[model samples]
Target chain A: MSDNQSSGPLVWLGTVLATCITLYLFQGILWLVVPILLSIILYYVTEPLVYRLTHHGWSRESAAGLVMGGLVLLLLAITAVTLPRFASKVTTWNEQKIISNYVQHGADFVESTLRTVEKYVPFIDEYMMSKARDNANWDEQLAKWAADNSSHTIMGLLHWIPSLLLIPYLTYFILVDGSQFKRFLVRAIPNAYFEKSLLLLHRIDDQVRRYFQGLMALTVIDAACLGIGLKLMGISGAFVLGLVIAVLSWIPYVGSIVGCLLVVLVAATDYASQTWMTYGAVALFLGVRLLDDFVFMPMTIGRSLQIHPVVTVLMIFVGGAVSGISGLLLVMPVLGVMMVLGQILGQLATNDRLTARYQFRKALLRARAQKGLEA
Target chain B: MLFSLGKKKNPRLAQLKGVSLFNDLKLSQLRIVNSLLHERNYLESELIFDQGDEGQALYIVASGKVRTHRDNQPEDKFVEFGPGDFFGELALLEDAPRSTSARAVEDTVLLALFRTEFLALLELHSSIGSMISYALARDLSRKLRKAIVSNENPTNL
Candidate 1:
């Protein structure tokens, strides 16, 4: 919640350059990065409980172990209770070819809409609609794009599963030994820069904590809004659907589209006799999305990770030009963190007193190291 | 000195136990606390910190001596700290400017316990944190009482 301190222009330039390069690299080693990202989230999610246990007189190891142990037990219990029922339902659904039925229902809605549109405007039916269509080049581009993207989604999920399984193990160590690792890193900083480094680290840690906490609050609000609206509108399992969509929205742009499309599909199939229900569902989704952008977002995530509207807009375009989709999605959070790092580094670079002390410490240390080794 | 507890073979841990702030911590906890400290050396008469500098650490004299006095006021003296003694304890509790400047009275090695790391220790291991906090509070109480008594009798000096 603390506003990031001001830094020099050089720092801002460095921050942008660093963010672009990091986003570019993330596109390559996504396998490693994905699990690390998930683990960090899981770490943040469970850290407060561990801290609570430590406050009650447990050592870090015991507290972390107990917390993670309870988590594993809860997960296993959920799996044990749900997996058999899920398997049975999936088998029954597959026999009915429910997926194709849903697709058919969606197609029916599209066809009816088209027919209605044709009534209002003649030459809109299939026969003369071909005359209104563009050319071979556009069709070819659409076909090529579909072919390129079609198989990757399934393959990408498969590729990430094994890595995703590493989240719990990684998160556990981060909970238990994270402080020790921090100490190890701190030990490497020379004493001249030590206090400043620690201060910066504390500030960064607080910022990150607030950011994640805000994210969780957003998820709860979004789920409650969507769930209650859909339930009131007579959708079955609406709360669960809303929860899934809210969680999916955590992944940024791609997730939002997929989640919206999924809800539209469910609404279409579930109320095949009432095409109006599907229309209402779509309308509801858009309204929630609008509110998310204009209100909920500012109240939650935006409050913690504040950026100037102008800089955010500019960096978005720059991010798109440099690294494409991932950059566009990640630039904001990366900028948030980079702003803090730059502020601290800028302060260090400009502090003549600290620089003098650093030089003295280094010279003194070097002389001590070389004292008996001289020829 | 008699209550000081640590294995004699590990001199660094032993030295940490000698400091009142860390005296009550177990050997294992002391090691954890010890790892958070940064070591620095200062030549005789070298400035450790300025009067107005943002205080971020409590500096404990590991060897030699240190003097605290106001900047540019030769007659204004606060206190002198020798080996096993610490100055700048207030920095651990909050972010504030130093009330007095510190300089090495002799070639000195200091173990600096920074606020951020110490606070992390407080979160992760409260017993170690509470022990040190108690020591700091007790020391501050003593200083306050002394100041009050001194004010009551100006000739006590």
Candidate 2:
């Protein structure tokens, strides 16, 4: 009975130890984790289709192959259609007239704003005036930063191509074999806890699947809203930028801020003279944020995770500190899984039947030990 | 001998048809149900599940025999179940503790349909879900009626 009482804490301690070990190991192979995570996400995305096809008498292998093949062709078509157009846009964007004009106008707007501030508060005008004069080449600075980041981004993508190529292959296997793997795991569990363990696993699977599918829906809707909003405001490359921001929004707090800054900068650069358009762009972004917070998220995701806001913020920071971007993206889902496991385990600990079984098992073990000693 | 290899024909589909829970399902629905089943082999005297363990799956005896007994009751007060007989139906409806322990009376082959898989199937095909749920309810009602009748006239046994 005493042993049964102590088992829960011991299990929790072991879990903590295992997690620490995993974190330590994960840091060294951070690069490999991306494709694996993407494959898992892709598996979830494509799994339903595989099951649906199998229901129509197609074997699992054939269904998985067909789905993955279609995915590959779709990706190829998108790349072939978009790459040349994107390259031409990049060329036009780099032109001196387009970039320099936008930058000069941005600087002038800032200068005017500072002058207005100086008018209201005379004490800081001299200091602000000095800073504004020194910041006259802000356009050139902006261009330099853009050039540096773009080059870095291109190089990073090129390096990532090999890993990215593995996604479909990994996804194919996962779709085909995921059920078998789950059954194999279930079979490995001891008979005593088989049902409880299976229930816990299923609960986790259902919740995670819902959370991810909801998240995907949210991202797509956000991208469409942002893209249409920007295009109506006459912004170029609006769809592409919207898509980028939508993807970034997966990173919780940091993502929204970064996305906002990106929209503001691009709007300021493209429609510099029309300050009202810039304000409109900001308004559009805020409106979308409001829609996300109030409508889309609630409808799609609901309160599935049930995480406290404070805990979420803390986990985001901890994840960021540990694994950078990937950690930020993954922390919420990991926390959700942990929450499910904790809830199930807590229930098991309090379950009268389970507690009694634990005590019985303990007694049986002790009796066996006593017999061994006598022998 | 309970886990002996059977003929080339897939026994699972045939066995599923005999189970009352799947009685109303169409051919296509039966196939879907068949896809979700997981088969296990148990030796004679092997414990299938102990009384008081949480139940999460409905098990159908594909071959051999099984006996269910309650630990608190006299040893003779137990039921023997044979091929095509299903138990743990309540597990399919909810996560509940088993009321009696189940063990293989001989080498047994059982087909288990887990609650999670069944729920997933229900989400995919409402018609099949309705059929199975209805069958389950009817089966439970019949059992309750039989038990009540027996309790009213104990000499019937």
Candidate 3:
């Protein structure tokens, strides 16, 4: 809805439609799409430092290589230092048993709430409650499913490892040769639409870059706010939980609910005698959600997307309907990029001189081709 | 520091080095600037840009000719540009509409340095940016002085 994109609601709707369709298509090629998308994020995140080094008289190739090389070394060093400790801690815990315990706690909480309700209205008896509990053996069903799919889950992860490995390699090249590649693409544009096309490219690049950087900054803010709040509330593993919760919240509605439930579950099981802390945790989540609404959301990625709330909510539903969770996760960025593309194409189509020049160029080429061929 | 070294690698480097906006830049610096230019070819009588259109870049004529005229002005009242000459410098600084239209006078090859790219260059390389901005300011100031003198004394232009 910015002035440059005064192309009207149709363009907005088209942007939504294109984004939904693209998200659906992307789901089919997720292995490649996921890595490329991640690489693009990594590229944008590290681009400033690389370009800064280039500005300091270093050749772009060396600058990019040095930046990426240093980053990889740093990451590897961190992993080397932390992974053994993390792995040792994880191995000490019985993950399946822990999950089952949490699930059981959640189910017990629901049953107790129902039992309290039944006490108020005694017509619904213990016989009916037992039948309902038998029907809803969610913990047992989940445990069975996990036990069956353990090897299959490992195989699925193994499938993704190679594609994920492409990130550093792809990011390094994109950092080094991206501008040269852009120039290569620019060469194919005719003289008439040259400026418009180049500007369009710039705008699209800018929109995506802003969206990603904003998201990264937003994540950091969320993690800090939640981590500090939870740590103050005496929540165990507060920072780690906050980090997990923040990353989970990246998936919009589903993520927030799952994240909230996770915190509540951990709270309930960890301190069964102190019920007030669980309520406090829930209140803290609500407080953070409100803060996100009034402040962080506007200050970050939401501003970059620039879509109306109704449309964003609607597309999220449409996205979920079409491609499920991946669609929901990617809706905002896809819609943002699509909106820029739609607006630019709208502007280009409306330009009479540019189109005329394009036609004239085609005519000139045609005449040259036919010069000596005609009988 | 040596222009001849890179110029032999690519002749266009020498041509790019000649533009006063970039003439002071070292050969390696010149290569960075050259990488930013978008080369376009225009046939005779083809409009390069129209009056009132938002200016995004300054164009340097690498070869052939271009002519500029104000809105509704006759073709006779046009300023000509040839090799090493650049136009649309005003666009490089601001997001204002072009005050005049430009068109190719003959088959021409032009190199465009866009505003966004130029601004980034300014932020990135201070010395090179200072040189280009200084040259631009000097040329614009000279034109302003010429205009003032012409208004004060007729036939001075």
Candidate 4:
């Protein structure tokens, strides 16, 4: 028991070292991570349906197939309905004259607003004027950056398209053979910790599933709220804008701010003459943010991740630094998994039965040693 | 995409039926239990588990024979268990150290039902769970009664 107790910390340290090495190796093949992560998300999203089908006597394979088939059909229907409208939107957006007019008018409005501020506060005119010049230069730089990155972005998407096609195939295998895979993993555990390890795995699995489900629910609600608000305010392509914002909103607090700024910019450009409409867009965003914080978030995501606010903020920054957007999206879920593992390890350290077993073995070994000495 | 050649019936289901712990279960309930079983093969004299090791699963002999003995006991002081017999049933309820070590007496096959999997099944199907729990309690009661009787009259056996 004493020997086993002493080795516990050593085992934990070894595990942490192994994990760090694994992650470093994994970063080398990071391109493969996105599809695998997406497949995992897809698996959780479709798992309940598969389980329900199995409960009703369908084979696991058949149920997985049925779900995947339904998903493909849904994708086809969405594409058939939306492709032509999307193409037209793209063509309209490509008309440089309309875009240049919007940008010129937007810059003029900002300059005028700064002049009005300078009139009221004369002493800060120099500082305000410099800021206004910086803002104008910022806009030009942003446009130049977008123009430069457009081809690179398109090429990235093209590369991703083939890998994205692998998600369903990966998800299908996961759904059908997941249990066997789990059993295979369980078999690797030492007999002493086998049941405890299995329980820990199940808990982690449940937490991850809930986290993904909550995220999906949150995305849909956010998009719907944004879409309805923008449409009622007479904005064109409200649904599309809402969808883009919703996807971006996966980056947590930063995403929401970015999304709000995007909507306001679009409102300023497209409906500049009606200044009240810009205010309306701002009001609409605040209302949605309030709804998200008070209602949608608590009900959908709750405190399942159980991360501290400070740690979550730090994680977001670190993730952004490490792997950019994908890392930002994944950080919270990864931390949640880590927390679960940490909690399990804590439990194992204090497990009475396991400790008692160790004591028993220790006593047996001691008895044998004493008997040998007597001989 | 690995396919079995045919609808191979799990032989362990038949062996499970003979165990008193599962005697009250309906065929459909038995089938559900069967789905949770994992089969393992052992060569002659191979250790199934060691005395004082933590137990996580109950095992039923699907074929051949097994020997159970305490580490402190003489080698000949062992119990031979054959097909349809089960051991370590207490593990299904709680994690506990094995009281006796078990080994295959001959090339053998055994079916193991892990506690976690069993608990999951119970959570999903409460009615079956209650029935199995009741049967398990009754079986334990019977075994306790037999042990008490044997202890009271050592010469009877």
Candidate 5:
């Protein structure tokens, strides 16, 4: 008993070390797995469209081909058209607008703030100048850090490029052969738990599908409202602002706030004299958010998801910590899927009280029918 | 109970997969049936049809529960059905009165298609009829198993 007790700590330590090593060794493989998982989810989301076309008497292969072909064409067109336009827009913004305005306003604000501070503490100006010197010299430190980090940085990029390439390829195959993949997955599960596992998987899949579709719908509504509101407010770059808001909305609570801040800042910079316009921009975001909470979210996404705001926020943080922006956007859906899986698994594990009730009702009916025959 | 032997109309209606009769329908037949599906919704406790009502459309529960009952049956004798389960199919296929009255157990959603839809499905894809029949057979077998188990322990209640 003493020996066993003494070995317990050792055993746990060994287990922890083994886990760490295994994770380290398999990190690249895990990176590769992300695109595969992402592609599978994308396939499920897109499959209904293909299925609809096929259902209309089109051949399965033909339907898949047509949809895939159209998607490719659309992507090619967007890349060809949008990429150059976006680049030129960025260039124009940088050359014509960005540097001069930002520097002028920023310099004025800094000078005023420093003057106020120096009025209180005469030595504060010297202290601030030293701080400014430190900031101005930050690039040297960054350069040194970059030199030190070069090997790891290159390695990380090399690691990521293959995973990035895998996404499109994986999505393509998943789109083409998703049914076969499902069959393969189902076959891999043990027979004893096959039915329950399949049911749980299907439930999770359904939840993800509905949540994603609802999110897409909500994104569109958000973009439309934000665009129209901004346009009505006579805000320049309404389309870009709306696009940013729509994309950011995927990040949940923080996303909208960030978009609001950007809009407010832009409004402040654009119409500094017309302060009311800044207030209007803030009001617009707040109003839309209220509408989202009261009507849009409930109508589009349903209250059944019932995720707590705190948990939603925490998940966003955890997701960002784990995988940056993509993780932040996807974490809620991942949590949603996990919640559904937990519910279904719980139901499966529970004693069949409802099924028992069903059985009892069936028996009572059967006995009464037999008695009627005898009479 | 009208069914015509003509080409389909409104392709979008038949394209959805969750309709009760067409849940397992082949892609080829779905295009045919897509023209035949009629979507309908009901409030809580609404009666879809009486047991003796002429059955026209086979009903598929989309988003809510439904209850089916035969006339002269005890109140507790109704069978509860949920999403993906369907009823009134027998009448649609056989051109007869409904075997059971269907009531919305909750705020219910349903997708229905008439005899023409099934006929269109049948004409377009021969495999679907057999697939439905096979599924129904398997479902009946499962029900029979439950019935047998209950019969063995009636006194257990």
Candidate 6:
């Protein structure tokens, strides 16, 4: 392989190892960083509004305060209306024999699908009912496991609370002192790289801002479409389903799958005809996913970001592994910043600037030559 | 335009400390700016300044927003100015006529610094002159880059 091909894998492996080591070593600091990360993401999304407000004669503080207040109000509205309904539905689903129906049907589906495939492929037929037996007893084991692990989980949650608190506090300071923060960063950088750093910061900020803001708009659109469709179908818990799907959509591919599975489960358990409701739920999910992937996403983020689906999936997977759900939520923006860094690195490694300059110069020469030839 | 900065604390002026332009300046210099700022209030639909008028003060959005637009047309292209954002700087800094008229988009309060007072501060403390120039240049570059992206025409940049 050429030097570039060989170095690519080596560099990536190094990065993976380095990331793992850092996370392992500084687990405590990671908590504090999470909120700051979230806040920065929020800042990126809200900065344009701030700029607009500032342009119109509102002070930055007042604009930020208004935007933050508006955001808090929005969150409160969602909590007040949606939370109780969501909890009630979850509780009912657990209590009303729905869980047993789901597990039985799920196991049946798995067995049937495996058997059909095993007829051709034979070796994979090792998937037996023994796995279902093991899972049937899973709840009994789970209670014991929870009894043993509850303390650790609680401790971890407690550990995370402080970090969560720190994040919002950090965010407030970041917002209040954002200008000074920028100046401090700029001055800290040597003058030679100041312009490039500023440009990089602006690009990263813009990409992140657009991704988050566009996603927020898309979530509303998705939820509205899904909720309306479900309501039209007279499906119970359509609003909850819609809200769940909208939030899940942020997690990329697997998130959507989970949302679809949940909707299907609800439809299957709640309605009389499993077949029709299954079909309806599947069609609804597929239709919305199609519309989003084909139409809305393209018009909004895909066009601006130009990220490929394969890359998007892989990034989401890596992000999931690294920081769990939060990582998945943030992966796209992080990838955007990384991609920008990658391009710069690629340029440096290949010394591609001369080639770019030459190409442009060649175009100019060709235009001049064509003009002379015409004359 | 001159207003005294007494021992009484002002929240709006205190917030000015966070802005980059005033970040490096001494507290005393900020006190000077506070003294120079005049509190101006306007009703809805009131014109703060008109296009082609010499901008006499850099207006900071104190409590409400203002709308900026060019000479009369169908729709006013509003760049909503709110708290902590300073405008009329283009005219104030360049000594040019206002590029667009600033009208109170709502019932608004503004902190205004007269051009003469601003000039006098720069005259007294020349360091601010360079700082303001640097800040403007930086801001203009950012705006230009943003315009390039939004307009989808890099050649314009």
How many steric clashes between backbone atoms does each model show?
A: 0, 0, 0, 0, 3, 18
RMSD of each: 5.8, 5.9, 4.3, 6.7, 15.3, 17.3
In the range A94-149, model 2's lDDT, one tens digit per residue, is 56444444555566556665666788988885875867667657757875666556
TM-score of chain B of each: 0.88, 0.87, 0.89, 0.83, 0.70, 0.79
- Model 5: residues >4 Å from true position, as ranges? A1-41, A91-169, A322-327, A341-375, B1-131, B134-157
* Model 6 spans with C-alpha error above 4 angstroms: A1-30, A80-172, A303-308, A318-333, A341-375, B1-157
Model 1 / residue B66 / CA error / Å: 3.0
A48-114: candidate 1 lDDT, tens digit per residue: 8888887787876788888888887998898799879866765655456555555556655665666
TM-score for chain A as predicted in candidate 1: 0.76
Cα error of candidate 5 at position A202, Å: 2.2
Superior by TM-score: candidate 3 or candidate 6: 3
Q: lDDT per residue, candidate 3, A1-375, as tens digits?
A: 123747667876788779978998999888888888788898998898887887778877798899888988998898799878865654544454555566666556656657777889788887887788778686577655644555565567769978987888899988876777788778887787888778778877887887788778788888888889889988878888888888888766677898898888777766665667777888888788788878998798776656666877787788888898778878766776787778887888778877887887678667767988967
Candidate 1 at B109: error in angstroms? 3.9
lDDT of 4 by residue, A313-345 (tens): 877786666656666766665555555565666
Going through the candidates in order, their DockQ values are 0.32, 0.25, 0.40, 0.15, 0.05, 0.02
Pairs in steric clash, model 2:
none
What lDDT does candidate 6 reach at residue A86?
62
Off by over 4 Å in 4: A1-28, A88-126, A132-136, A339-375, B1-18, B21-35, B38-116, B122-134, B137-157
Stretches > 4 Å off in candidate 2: A1-24, A51-59, A87-146, A345-375, B1-35, B39-55, B61-66, B70-75, B82-84, B93-110, B119-149, B152-157
Q: Pick by DockQ: which candidate is best? A: 3
Give the C-alpha miss distance for residue A13 in model 5, angstroms: 21
In candidate 2 the C-alpha lDDT for residue B17 amounts to 84
Model 4 docking tier (incorrect/acceptable/medium/high): incorrect
Stronger candidate by DockQ (3 vs 5): 3
Docking class of 5: incorrect
lDDT-best of 3 and 5: 3
For candidate 5, write residues B1-157 as lDDT tens digits. Answer: 1222234454444435655445687665565454344456565665666665546667777679999877776788778888777776665457566777777888777766556446645544558766766765665566667878777322111
User: On residues B83-152, what C-alpha lDDT tens digit does candidate 6 reach at each position?
Assistant: 7777777645665667777777777777765565566556555676566557656766776789877883
lDDT of 4: 0.72
TM-scores for all candidates: the values are: 0.78, 0.77, 0.87, 0.74, 0.53, 0.54
